[model samples]
Target: MSPGPRLPRRTLLKASAALALPWLLGRCGLPENEEGLRLDPDGILDLPEGFRYRILERRGDRMSDGFRVPGQPDGMGCFAGPPGSNTLVLMRNHELEPGQDSLSPYTQDQGRPAQAYRPADNSPGGVSRVVVDATSFERVSSNLVLVGSSRNCAGGASPWGWLTCEESVTEGHGYVFLCDPLADSLQDAVRIPALGKMNHEAAVVDPTSFIAYLTEDRSDGCFYRFVPESPGERLGLESRGRLQALRIEAEPRRDMNAGVEPGATFRADWVDLPRPGAEDDSLRAQGAARGAALFRRGEGLFFHEGSVYFCATTGGPESGGQIWRYTPEGLQGGMLQLLAQSRDRGVLDMPDNLCVAPWGDVVMAEDGADPRWPDEHLRILTPSGQVKNLARNAMGGGELAGVCLSPDGRALFVNMQGDGMTLVITGPFQQYTGTGL
Candidate 1:
């Protein structure tokens, strides 16, 4: 395979034009100022162009409730509610194994999910809902939504209007649960098993169809789709339907045995994942078994305009992280196509949570193990596949997980698991008309 495109210094200079103009004009304007800020083509945090970043909420900031921000916060979504009352829901994935670092929100009230029915000690997982002051851009009311799981990773919002945070694994009660933001019933967290049980990372639901798409977070992780046979069934209740995985029948030997990098383009023939609670011993090989061959080490998935977008956390000798686009109208009538692969472009050093901007732009969060990438960072790629950094960890280099744009497209809510605080990026983020945002 051909080597992916490299990020050259000249291209970086071209991409930085928006930031360079103000710096150049400052020399000629009033007093000599070295700092002047402006919005770049890449969707970075908007500030006073000249004024530098001021960290508002750090890892150990004390909250009004006396509970501090927890361990590395991951996948989060920002919803635009009433004026001055924006709700920011975050999934703080406690990336703990059997024995590792302790999870966050140290107090008793902060320890468990807002409601935990299937309880367990020494293991707790959940999400936090924080109110963001739209005008002042402050962190307001934040609380836990789920609890008592492990390695909770990136999840997605449902067609039914609740956030589904996926547990990276499914041992114990590490299952996918629906979080009804408006529910005041105080019901214990409800886990949806029809979605299949494994190492899950995120979920994408088709509002029109209510079919929930899911991604697994392991190297052998499987990609699944829970198709509600009813298509309009209510959540929580199990529906009669099938969970199918993608199997490459034509190139089983090549695809099953081809342990190198995937083909230049991603093309998967759909197969079926056995219904959960079935016999584990299979009759076929790993490659020919019922599964999703779209990509290995799957991480995040989002659905848009009849197409599914996903990211592969790892796979390949050199191409560890990649983003693949699967459109139903492909070779198999309903197949997966590699519309764009970060490995092909050398952009995604390590990609995690994903979201689509209002303008059809794909925003990816970087969850790199090694600090930050020189050119690879939280990025925005256009439909044409041109990629640019939206935000780099020049300020902080933690695995940037769970990224979502506000419904109004005003701000981008991001999580740096290692950083511990759900950072909100909004300011004079205006498009600046002619000035830029």
Candidate 2:
């Protein structure tokens, strides 16, 4: 069966309708269309100077192992090995199934459905590598990395190295796996069960402390963080760790208990009530729950300037899809800031995942929207709560998922989820931001 229809590459920007949502639209002012740049009905996805995109190794791009890379591609990450050794390790979530839809040996089984993420089974949906040149934006490597991971969505890198690909399926076996693209074969894939058993979207690690802040893609899913009892020496497997929830301002809720590392926990470890719906079994219940026991479908996460920031596809009780911030000085003290409320930001248009830029701006990808909207876009928000239209989706009709600006703050890499391709953006980063604020 075909996947969800591709959202139009360009759609009209949803001018904020409410007086209360400037924090969502962000600091940048919306620029009226001019200069004749291409945009779709969704009003999203714009490419910058000295840059253009093409279909790289597409879905059927034959791998060394011989199975065609099928299924809808989702979350991805890129690493620059040495200079210009652009090897991109992408966790392409297949959203696959059994029967003819299954890959290889699973097809021979006849009736039994395959596990979503057992790589040893060599399933079709999971993580893969795409080596490219940073300078030229050309794909160099031609191998698919990990295979059986179910619904491998957006994942981030640990400061040391390696990528954590998240399995976004609640049932039928879901997990989070580590991938090292530079290596010849995949090894040491960490399956941290304490992180919860919901449909996970992505995770961010604090290299300074080695805590994993993760989000679930389900509507009522809960947000989580795994605190390494023995901190991993930066971007690696720690000697020990425990998964905890994000305790909000209303943390001391009457319902749940406290975390094991509450006093010692450096990151937020108390989970609040998600929504009334979050009580579903998807949550990997462990430490006593607190605050909002549910979540609004957490997506992506990043740690910057001593603060851990993440996104929820669906917002909270009052909001729908919000970008939240949490700062903790260990279990001693912390605060969860609502930050920018999206219902007021460009009609929300349905945000998926997000990344941070050099100017300390949070860039978000708007993927899901109603049929009425004609364009989709990658948005940016400053810490001060300002939003701007960074790029318009012009990959014909692709959902821009993962986004990142190079370390030197040069080129920006964006993944087109609908088409399974990565594009690079360069030029003025600040001049592009604006705010209704």
Candidate 3:
């Protein structure tokens, strides 16, 4: 079947009246007949008239460490390079499996690292580091940082390091691993079992509480939070913690896939899991037995302004998508709100990864619900519940993933997973980002 129609390029200006969301239009200060996406001459990506993208890294490209760039670039995080430096560090993940040896970064002669997790097997998924000059927007160096993990899909950045989560449970590889961006060579493979062993999609740490929030990528997944024994530890992932699942205060075992209003709010509580580090794939079931709330494939988590924003790839009545917000009130309780959900696939289809804009808007990476029509896009969801396209994948090679903005918000980095391409788009970002919200 054919997919949904594409949203009009001129829709952003009229959103205030059409959706009655004046808060977004008033704060954005966008002018009429501007900020519309124009087709790229190369037919790879379409962006606004003033915006342009630069191909930073791609599959098969050789790195400084003498290994070719791996395929299936998924989730990524951008960090400041170093003190008194004008460069930025990017940790990119490759979602490869054991049999995909052709896409491995290591050659046959080199083999895998001695400290790799399950070194006997041939798991090629890991994280790679790329350094770029912030001023010039040029790549400085690229190399492998972590190795031997399976399906390092989507992860989040923390002050300690990048929390790269494995999206697989086979061979005991469904745990989160922290990778230091400053490490030039491959680091030892260490898993944080305290974070729970399940099909992890992404993770983020609350700066104030030092508690980590994680998402599971299964249809029956449950949202989780980890409270470390030592909250002040620099590298808190290794510390032992109590893992708990979210539960609705009013209703127990609430299914969040459908029948949720756009602005619905709920008092949220947590239930502790006796065994977070389980050998089998039973963490979700364990949470369910204890009255934990359920989600439809939870993915892509970001902590912004004291709230955690996450997405459910296949939620809503039409299975389009859903974006949720969780604000931790204290160590014991929080408020959960259904910020926005897609009723039409054309407007917001399968939002996989997302990041908040510098000016307080939510930016999303669209993984289209249907593969037949490959018009995936990088979309923006306003606080007032309006959606608009920021960029379109004209190439139709893959779904957009790893949507992140630099610390300075001058550059936006995204990846095309199936095509194995990473790009940085730069333009007049300040036009929409007014003086803070």
**Candidates sorted by lDDT, best first:** 3, 2, 1
Residue 90 accuracy (lDDT) in model 2: 35
lDDT of 2 by residue, 257-375 (tens): 12211111222446432331232443544323444345566777777766776776656333336666677667534655555544333345567777766566678887755455445
Which candidate leads the pack in TM-score?
3
- TM-score of each model, paired residue for residue: 0.74, 0.74, 0.91
Best lDDT among the predictions, by candidate number: 3
Better structure of 2 and 3 per TM-score = 3
Worst lDDT run of 10 residues, candidate 2, spans 255-264
Lowest lDDT block of 10, candidate 1: 12-21
Q: Count of backbone clashes for each model?
A: 15, 55, 0
Ranking by TM-score: 3, 1, 2
The sequence of per-residue lDDT tens digits that candidate 3 reaches over residues 1-437 is 12224443322221221121223322222222214777687878888767889999989898998877899899999988887888999999999889998888876678677767787767889999999998977899999988889999999977688999999999768989989988877788657888888999999898888899999999999999989888867653467878999999888899998577665778999999978878798988989999999999999999888889899999888788888888888899888877677665655678999998766667889887575445888877665544556788878636899999998888999998888889999987656433243
Model 2 residue runs over 4 Å out of place are 1-28, 31-51, 63-70, 82-122, 163-172, 186-189, 233-239, 249-289, 316-320, 331-333, 344-347, 383-386, 395-398, 434-437
